[model samples]
Target: MLQLSCLCGQVRIALKQRPDFVNECNCTLCSKSGAHWSYFHPSDVEIEGETSQYSRQDKDDPAASVHFCPDCGSTTHFTLTESAISRFGNVQSGVNMLLADESDLAGVELRYPDGRAWFGETDFGYVREPRIIGQKDTQP
Candidate 1:
């Protein structure tokens, strides 16, 4: 199992299996939060402790509600909103992989998705190529 905690240690998350890849998005919300997200089904993840939730006030129908540790203000995770769940069933929750130690994420692929260009209609294009965590560049 993989364990992650907030800076204040007020919030904790356990994942049954490590994620294959983590997403680094460039959307306004994600960029501001500085979150590297790993997606998983809610059943595959276990979250402990109370969290403060925030939904985007800028959108009329925000897709997800972000959760954070109130004390340290660290982003912990995000869950699909009711409207989003209704629209896209079986949606996965996102855990802030940034909370995990860098050593723990060795060999994991980091993908840069172009969220800035995504408008809720089509698949996301890559903002940049993916890279393996903790791996040295062989060509350099």
Candidate 2:
């Protein structure tokens, strides 16, 4: 199990097991929040404390809602909205890796996904390639 908390400890998240991999996206909200995301079923996580929420419309539907610590303003986690839930089902949620200890992620892989391109209506003039985050540095 891994324990995750905001900078001020106002919000805490407990994960039953370490994630095998994490996804880093360049979407508008994700880029600003700087979250390294690991997915799990909501039931697999334990959240404690009060969190403020920020929701936004995407593709004409409420797409996502971000939950953050009111005191420290650190983003703890995010969940898809009803529109997304209807499409993807309530099967997974994202946990911010920045809130987790490094030891808890010792062997996990980091994946870079082109979420910006995938979700945006226009090209957004930025193209990203999917790759393992640290694979290049470790290569011979």
lDDT of each: 0.93, 0.80
Question: Residue 11 of candidate 2: its Cα lDDT?
Answer: 96
- Against the true structure, candidate 2 reaches a TM-score of 0.81
Task: Show where candidate 1 strays beyond 4 Å.
Answer: 137-140
Cα displacement (angstroms), candidate 2, residue 100, comes to 0.6
lDDT of 1 by residue, 1-140 (tens): 99999999999999999999999999999989879999999899999999999999999999899999999999999999999899998569999999999889999999989998999799999977788999974533
- Give residue 130's lDDT in candidate 2 (0 to 100): 39
Provide the TM-score for each candidate, comma-separated.
Answer: 0.94, 0.81
Model 2 lDDT tens row, 61-121: 7667888899999989988888889998988788998898776676677766666667457
Write down the RMSD of all candidates, one decimal each: 1.7, 3.8
Give the number of the best model, judged by TM-score: 1
RMSD of 2: 3.8
